[model samples]
Target: MAGLAVGAVVVLALLVLLRRRYVVARVWGHSMSPTFHDGERVVATRRRHYRVGDVIVFRPRSRTTDVAWRIKRIAAVAGDPVPAWLETDHPVVPAGRVVVVGDNTGHSEDSRQLGYIDLAAVAGAVPHRAAPEGS
Candidate 1:
């Protein structure tokens, strides 16, 4: 019994550490429709790298946005050539910045209007294979 209790404690501690590195966010709008819907929950893990097509949660620091957190798919990353769809001065995505867009282009307020999102603003990236809570 004592051995089982000790193992449980160790597992609990590991979960706590993992929780700190991962964040759960609920989709709030139609931006990610078809992939994620409003009220669906996703788990995102904070890591040193992110790639195009990976959906991520971030806080928009620009004056145009008021939402505390926004979910969008990465379109470009550092060293990648800028997508022709974007109107920006830089030919390549600058270091430490990324271009993000909504899967549903018509409803997303993304890098198209907001410009490059600072990597520091990114909370985490949701794996493409993870199933959302509400389906």
Candidate 2:
């Protein structure tokens, strides 16, 4: 019983640390193709803010899907206005919004397709790709 208690405590500590540090997500769709493939797993850090060029996942505001977990490069941050082609009426990204774009424009459906994502929608920033076994 004593050993069990200690083991439980250790496991809880690890879970807390891991949750505060990183999150793992499986890649879906081809929005970020060539950079992150479908079915691949990626590790993202739960950091405060991401810099330009950082790959991130956030929710999309489109009718096709309620929640879109897309990997896109941070093009601009809050207070910055997105390009004209992306949208026409949406104001500059708010103080808590992030402008993300796909690395591959040809196939990616991102800010260009929808709009800026609120910082609250950001799940995390990808730190590294986890390759599947035998590949």
Candidate 3:
């Protein structure tokens, strides 16, 4: 009986933490494939400071469609150096925004296509998978 009570408390605490720190999202394309497959579920923490190469979930400001969210890796963060390889004439990442891209470049619509992502829209880094759990 004591073990059951302890298990319930642990589960409840985890749920509360998750509820406060993360928001659930679902991936739906090959844009981030190989890393995140189509129809894969994702959880991103609440908006916080992020660095380059971090995967984030955000809403694109340049998009006019009803699409809700997008998940991609941050290529550049506010005021960070933009590599010469990016092929952009404007080299530095703008303030309060980030340049994002997908693992699957060929199929992704990222900073390469649209403009930088607003920091205000960023949800936060996607949590790392602890194990090879199935989708």
Candidate 4:
């Protein structure tokens, strides 16, 4: 009886925590390949400070029918210069925006084609897969 009661309590706690703090999403494409594989599952926090080099899951700020969360690496913060390799006319990332890119740049569509993502559109930073709840 005690074991069952403890199990119920633990399940309740997990249900509440999953509802409030994290999102479990399955990766769907190769846009973020080499780092995150297609069909791999990821757990991301609801909100937090994100830094350059962090791989994040976010929806595009621009209008698009695609609703899937895209995973990409933050290449530059709000004020950093866009890399010359991007071949974009905009020299630097504008205020309140960040430039994200895929590891497979040649085959991926990211900030270079989609434009700087809105700071608010950042859904969350994906913590290491080994520790889903630690973040």
Across 1-135, the per-residue lDDT of candidate 2 in tens digits comes to 999999999999999999778767777776677778888888778778777667887666654863346677787887777666676576676678777776557777777766777777777899754322322
Task: Tell me each candidate's TM-score.
Answer: 0.80, 0.78, 0.73, 0.72
Any idea what lDDT model 1 has? 0.87
- Candidate 1 clashing pairs, residues 3+ apart or interchain: none
lDDT of 4: 0.76
The residue-by-residue lDDT of candidate 3 on 25-106, one tens digit each, is 7886888877889889888988658877678888887666555889888878878887554667676887898888887778
User: Tens-digit lDDT track for model 4 on 87-129?
Assistant: 7778788787888887767667788888888878777878843
Candidate topping TM-score: 1
The 10-residue segment with the lowest total lDDT in model 1: 126-135
Candidate closer to the true structure by TM-score (higher is better), 1 or 4: 1
**Order of all candidates by TM-score, from best down to worst?**
1, 2, 3, 4
* Prediction 3 global C-alpha lDDT: 0.78
List model 1 lDDT by residue over 12-120, tens digit each. 9999998879988888889888788989988899989998878899888865545678899898999999999999888899999999988778888899988899999
Q: Give the TM-score (vs. native) of candidate 2.
A: 0.78
Comparing 2 and 4 on lDDT, the stronger one: 4
Model 3 misplaced regions, further than 4 Å: 1-20, 64-66, 85-89, 129-135
Per candidate, the number of residue pairs that clash is 0, 0, 0, 0
